[model samples]
Target: MPQETFTLQIRQIRLETDDVLSFELASPTQNPLPVAPAGAHLELHLPGALQRSYSLLDEGLGGCYRIAVKREPQSRGGSAWLHSQARVGQTLQAQAPRNDFALNEHAPESILIAGGIGITPLLAMARRLNRLGHRWSLHYAAPSPDRMAYRDCLQALAADGHGSLHTYCSSEDRRLDIAAVVRASGPQAHLYCCGPAGLIDDFITATQDRPPERVHYERFAARHAASTEGGYEALLARSGKTVKVSAGRTLLDAILDAGVDIPYACSQGVCGTCRTRVISGTPDHRDECLTEAERQSNEAIIPCCSGALSSTLVLDL
Candidate 1:
């Protein structure tokens, strides 16, 4: 399936809180909005910045497209740029929606756990679940009511509907009761969570007894421990250039730093953006998007998150 990337001007920007904004992009563009399910996210190519991924909050039917973004205290510059600087009427390049967190049709009950900004994707799931009248529950954890995105709307939906929505103000409470929520779910219920790495780790631990396939997780950051040795050099066969990327930096970063552009999204590796043909070299795969066969072939790897394991890896570029 080919994705249609389009440039749209920002139609509106609503401040959800001090740092979060619910951005609305113009809908009537050259490429029409496709029908996207809950958990679908778009890859944004910020002006003069690396590609960043954001979950789609609004359904495709709306005349406008909405996405909620929270400014991170220690961001790599993407969120900070969007939160503090990106203005309405500015044009931004965005790719078509990609969904890796769709609801499990086999699941009788859906349990969503969100932490802080992680609520963006899960909120979409709640919307579809509510409309479908499915058995579902959401546990949203934030520092306070003010920090919660879409507070009034989420609360109203939860109150007026059958789905149970629970909020945990972590500033008031020491920690969210993950154990309780996991234990409360029925044996066959599906668990979907997206948040900080700590919450994800804890959730995985709590569900150790459950089947692994039933538990779906989305990580926002790189969890791999840093490499002990120095970084390796990359050889772009198609471009005929040799670039050096440090251990802390990624192959995609090095290529971009060299003024070369390649397709990429969700630098986290889940979006399969920045995927390119690996002509040669052993790649240190860190992405969660590729399948076992894809990895075994060593033909395609997500350069955004993956690095070269060999001294000199060649990419089609």
Candidate 2:
């Protein structure tokens, strides 16, 4: 099946932070925008073939989707254009919502780690957990107090007794101790991390010994044109085909570039459209679409964002 294309109109824009703007997008033709769960993202097709994926901060029954965009210091035209040129009532093109990060409703508790603008998806998870009367905690880090987005909402969640919110500001000489946080979590608590590559790497290191089923993460595509998660060899079984995916390259991109056809929609591991079988090797499971059981089995891999935890992944291609 093909993904749906939508004509979205920017209905409103709210200033989230000094550098962040939250846009309220709705379909201009009264067509309902795709409903997305917490931790979902939508790809906005902008001018000059500039397509960028944004975390869906709010998905309402009123056919409106809210997403936050932070003006990157480098400004590669996606966030910069949204900040400068995107206007209310102007129509834009986008894909249906997809999620690479999703909350685990079944876990006894959730431990969320976020850095900078990475709060977008985690905020949604906090709200969902609150709505469901679940216990959760958020460890958020930012440059300064003012730089944190949705601080009021997170504080409100704390006030409402939905979750605990902890802030660590680097400017104040405070930092989130990944090891300490992981060490403090209960056994059944699922851990989720989405932030800068460095933060993610630290989180992974701290939780490496934990059950693979209990850890969930999403890649932050704002930086790192290739995967910063390291790289390895992908050996296709049938033709004995092999591609050495570099530290900066993704398995999906490398496979496609090799003219090896693999159907994939959202290259961020949300859609589950590109799930491939793994005959051998441990996969660095980073997709929300797969369950804990699936990950524990280590029988499949979402090649888009996921990589080989082992040096070589034997694909049953």
Candidate 3:
């Protein structure tokens, strides 16, 4: 797989519905898209917009990369800019592909549950599985069929006899039952889910009894925020260097300000690229990338966007 910077032109942009836009980005070169897994996402640097992570929707071939963007009315300009400001023919900087969510290699069957825009990554997975002629099923739940992104693509997959695709529209019917569907999916099936907070929470609660390791999930929203010092001190362990960051400044910013270079992306803490070992002090882990156990162990921290709570944090640097 190739990992190189590319400028992608917005060859086409279609409003799938009032809240979603299906953007088909034209590649600059002829190389095929990297072989991305089910839950892989790319970092997009939209001009004048903050770096945001978007799940890859393309099947890793074709001349273009497709992504579905949901208009986030509550976001701080990320989704809003993507929906309102982005125009066709415009080019944007984007990274190739990265995967945090992958499939269970040895599993015989898999079940995919998607909520709203969370369907983007799973859609890619479904396409890949269909291409390989594998056994899988997808249950997609949305507020309405009109608001559902990539409805045509998913429909085509179902039409081709790839797998069963279930659509649950909650607007017209008050009794959209996801629990029953999940229950019938059977045990030993590798399950993957993505989407909004309410849906993710419901699914997590619904399938809590499943094998803890088999349930793979990812959050599109930022994780919990704690009352850290607003900012704190980061000590470079090897160099014996110290940098003070006030409220609003991240530990990565403080280190880079002191002429230290650390790899990072999606500074919002979604990508685990900037994760470094925590040598000492209390780490106020605020990243969406690490699990609860990883944070508790104090083994690593994403300093690029994470902060310190103990006033002084020693980093492996």
Candidate 4:
């Protein structure tokens, strides 16, 4: 089915912390919104073509969508705009919820690890697991207690014995040992992590020996590494055009320069929106969204941040 768009009115805006704020959006006509499962996110279509993806924090809340946004000092304007211009009475356009970091609900035991603003999605997972009486634990790490967004709710979950909550505060000299936490979760438990690249990389490295399917993660941003050497040629099959993708220029930009239209959001390679079918060619596969199996298949490529390995490539588009 094609994705749907809706206009929602901001009913409430509550500050979760010094830098984070939670916005509750509801249908303007008081109609029920689409039901979004835990770990789902919505793409907000802000003014000036500034689109940003935010995770929904509503685990059990009904008929509305809740999202927490953290203001980033070095933001590309999305967070800053929301923090400064968004108001309770304002209406915003947003895409329906989509889940790229879905939880494995059938797992007997689950382990959740979060860092900073990454806790938004995990918080919903924790709530669902607790309500369903599933065995789970959460480990949240932040710079300090004042920076943690949902401290009170997490504490209440721990107090109720629904799940164990372990917090690490860098100001208090506490460290989150990724290896220790992964090892303690046991081999059969499913692990979900969302955080900074360094933390996610550490967890991935620590769990390399474990079953790959048992470990899941979501990254907030793309890892900007040194580009590969040389330029490549991309053949747009549908457009009957050939475009030169320079080493400094991304494939998506090259294609667009050739007068081809492709849909994309979060050009950082974290979102799978720019995923395009590869009729033929070897993709360099720099994107963080695709799984190992998907990368190995070479059936699709995320053009926004990924490049081609072969000199000449063919794209379905």
Candidate maximizing lDDT? 4
- Name the better of 1 and 3 by lDDT: 1
Which regions of candidate 1 are displaced past 4 Å? 1-4, 28-31, 225-249, 254-261, 266-270, 277-281, 288-300, 310-317
Write down the RMSD of candidate 2 (Cα, Å): 5.5
TM-score of each: 0.84, 0.75, 0.87, 0.92
Query: Which residue runs does candidate 3 get wrong by more than 4 Å?
Result: 1-4, 174-176, 237-240, 256-267, 309-311
Q: Which regions of candidate 2 fall more than 4 Å away from where they truly are?
A: 222-317
Winner by TM-score: 4
**Candidate 1 local distance difference test against the native:** 0.80
What clash count goes with each model? Answer: 1, 1, 0, 0
lDDT of 1 by residue, 42-100 (tens): 77888665678888885655655688988888877788889888898898877877787
lDDT of 3 by residue, 1-317 (tens): 11356787888888888988888887766556556566787777776745677888855566677888888778766788888889988888877667887766556777898888899889888887787777788888888888878888898987777677888888968434657867887688888888877777787887889887788887875556533345577788876798888776677777777887665666667677678898888888888778878899887888765677687888887
Between prediction 1 and prediction 2, the one with superior TM-score is: 1
Of the two candidates 1 and 4, the one with more favorable lDDT, higher being better, is 4
Cα lDDT of model 4 by residue, 1-317, tens digit: 12557888998999999999999988898876777888988888888877788888865277788899999999888899999999998998887777888988889889999999999999999888887878889999999999999989988876777689999999999989989998888779999999999989998998898898899899998886423443899999988999988767888888878878786667788878778999998998888889989999999999888888889779987
- How good is model 1 by TM-score? 0.84
Candidate 1, poorest ten consecutive residues by summed lDDT:
221-230
